[model samples]
Target: MEPAMACHADRTAPVFQTKGLTKTYRQGDVEVHALRGVDISLYPGELVVMLGASGSGKSTLLNILGGLDVPTTGEVRYQDIDLAGASDRELTRYRRDYVGFVFQFYNLIPSLTARENVIAVTEIARDPMAPEEALDMVGLASRLDHFPAQLSGGEQQRVAIARAISKRPRVLLCDEPTGALDSATGILVLAALERANRETGTTTVIITHNASIANMADRVITLSDGVISGEHRNSERQDPNTLSW
Candidate 1:
């Protein structure tokens, strides 16, 4: 594994920092700007909600931060490492070591039990939490032996979360994590997220279309047309019960 660059900043440093970051995709004669000169920072152990409409570039930004996509211009640093300039292998190692991701779809293997699914990641991880412990963290202790087909949508999502977090990554990025569920079930997913963030102290960034969900974040950022339009902080977080749709 490549050694991480030395960090000059103290504990106040952000887990991720982007300055004038931009990403453009080319298809035939047209160019699409998914993100436009956006500057942002994700702090350690804070839950941030990225709220916006469909074309707002929230997912694009999250993808870049997660090292799945690269920007066409500008700078992005993961801690002190230069992510924007990292080679493919370096980026792969970075993602493998420090990043955990959850998406809208629950991509578990139908034949694997919840604990087995979590173990799949733990095996490859450098230093991971026990699969059973991870499942318990997401309130799936009793369902550890259940297959994905037998689990509800919310339960499946929790298992996914357990799988992602079992590696004990420094950052957890979720893109539309609850988009597929009804409100009541979605709250369970949100509660899982809240519990994971509080207990593990992992820096988490969530991208969602629901404005009401922003109330639960330590900070909320809104995007529009590929740029950040607004950012704010809530003095106190609202529990899942208090969060509206």
Candidate 2:
């Protein structure tokens, strides 16, 4: 294992920061703790991979960071915005303007062409890339006219990525992005994400249980039982094409 790298982000302010973050959900008779005081920072233009098994609270953390949910306690800050205290409407605008999300499943519209699916998001974004450009970034230029059914699973996922990035968001959040794909197909998707981060300089965070995927990240944070267990920075990122799991 590589030794943990020192914090080099002090020169630039973090794009997102959290302190004493916690979330609790009530079930029929029990209260489940999803997060137990998570404190972290994400810098601009860095690729981070969070590793954890199911129920490790990675998804909960991602949802809060994306403004889809609020923490029960503690501060969640996105630059100068107080995400933890933001109103529903403010969070909506923050998600719309600054955050982009890609999920494990490709939620492409079956009725819409690949380009059209991406255009759906671009239309609502404040300042967006051309739908064609976003699709092209993910190596889907040739399949723009194809509907979801006409494309392969990997291609459909790429379309989803294109849709998320079309808004030119400052932060890109991916939740198990390659979870549904075979190793070969997953590599392609990871490559597209790497390209997007490099080209657009979007701060990217990918949450997955796959440890192999961490090799491509600038930093890797491990979560266990709703708390951060370890963290380390890679001296260099490996090419996604060379990764196998």
* Winner by lDDT: 2
Worst 10 residues of 2 by lDDT: 2-11
Q: lDDT of each model, Cα atoms only?
A: 0.90, 0.93
Q: Estimate each model's TM-score.
A: 0.94, 0.96
Candidate 2 off by > 4 Å: 1-11
CA deviation > 4 Å runs, candidate 1: 1-11
lDDT of 2 at 101: 98
lDDT of 1 by residue, 217-239 (tens): 88899999999999998766778
Per-prediction CA RMSD (Å): 6.8, 2.9
